[model samples]
Target: MQELEKKEFERLLPYLYKRKERCPTFVFAVLERFIPGFVFADDLNSPKTIFVGTDSGLYFVGGPISNVAFNKHFLKFCSSKLKEGRRFTLFSGSGGWDGLISDCFRLELKQSSRYSFTFHPEEYGVKEVQLQEPFTVSRLDEATIRSSHEFNLEYYERFWGSAGHFLDKGFGYSVIDGETALAGECTSIFRGKVYAEIDIYVDAEYRGMGVAKKAAQAFIDHCLKNEMIPCWDCNVENLASRKLADRLGFREPSSYSIFVKNQ
Candidate 1:
């Protein structure tokens, strides 16, 4: 497999478009150069199979699944990357690709189901949240972003490369107790032409409270005000995330399989 340069990334867009369901937003993030990643294909000029890998995850799109040589090369590449300590969770909408991956890395891969949710405005109406003393909800600013890192805030760095990038092209909301951010909801992946994928995190000390929902509501409202479609995704096993999504107006969940390193 040949690695494609950034300029050649667009060549894979047609393959992405042909798929019936939405590919993960991180796929688009790599193509759009919003973040660092790699793309590989059987042939750059006219390719039938493509792979996109970012810090977030790995994806395979389009193919003649029976291409033994290509499949072998992919396995070797993945093996080498794993040895280098790079973590990857493979995602695809094609059963054929899933089967091929499952067969090749039977011992090393663990299978999991991921659920995607679509936002329904009619189901969600804004509600004011009352925070007890010393807590407040606010938009993420530079100072907030910097301070949040103390709480292990990673969405901005992981998806946007840096705080400057996120502040310029992305947005988020955080629930802070005094100067410490206890919870937040931000765009994990965003494409101006498409949608923003929501990522939420709450500190262990504040899990049961409604802090996450409060932050997510503000984030959702911002997306609506800007006419951006907000998207949600979570592992099928994460019942809490599912419940939160439903309460925030996300519905019609579609399930997909993902393969992650067993470790």
Candidate 2:
């Protein structure tokens, strides 16, 4: 497979936009901020298939444009990447990639259900609420990163690599109880300049309170102010998150299937 240059990468916009909800959001953001290092079959001028990788152990396939089948060359390329020791979760529209590898190689595919939710600013009516005792909402920044609870530190480290990266590449708000972070809502995956996937976490002790709700509202407000749209995706089994998305004015999530390689 030939690597696609930036100009060539832009040509996939129509295909990507056509399957917006099906594609991962980070693809959009990474293409905007970083070089995709994307590879495609044929020349960049017109590609029949596209492939890109993610830091989160995912290999994304965009298409087999114009009814073309993914050939042996591309499958070998995928095998080479998989041999690098990263377990891959493949995201492709429909069932095209279902057994493309297993049929030729020893690996297997395990499919799972996923959902995507989009926010509508017009449907969201911000509610003014009183700041009760010990509950405070504040924008997460360098100062807060240093002073926030261990949970927040672990969270930033896990998803963002470092608090510094989060500060530079992400934005969010935290609900604090005095000095402790009770809950937070931040961009887990940023997609282009216009969309971000929301990630929220609340301490187990504080679950029944409206901590997440308040923090998410503040986070959504920040997105709206900057003209960014917020997206929420969760496993179908996570009922609590599904309810939260509904309460936050996110439309019903669109369900999609993802193939995760069995480890």
Leading candidate by TM-score: 1
RMSD to truth, every model: 3.0, 3.3
The total number of steric clashes, by the backbone 3 Å criterion, in model 2 comes to 2
lDDT per residue, candidate 2, 146-256, as tens digits? Answer: 765543666666545667777777887878787765555444445467677777777777776788788788878888888988888888889998887888888868876
lDDT of 1 at 152: 30
Cα lDDT of all candidates, in order? 0.76, 0.67
**Residue 192 displacement (Å), model 2:** 2.0
- Each candidate's TM vs. the true structure? 0.83, 0.81
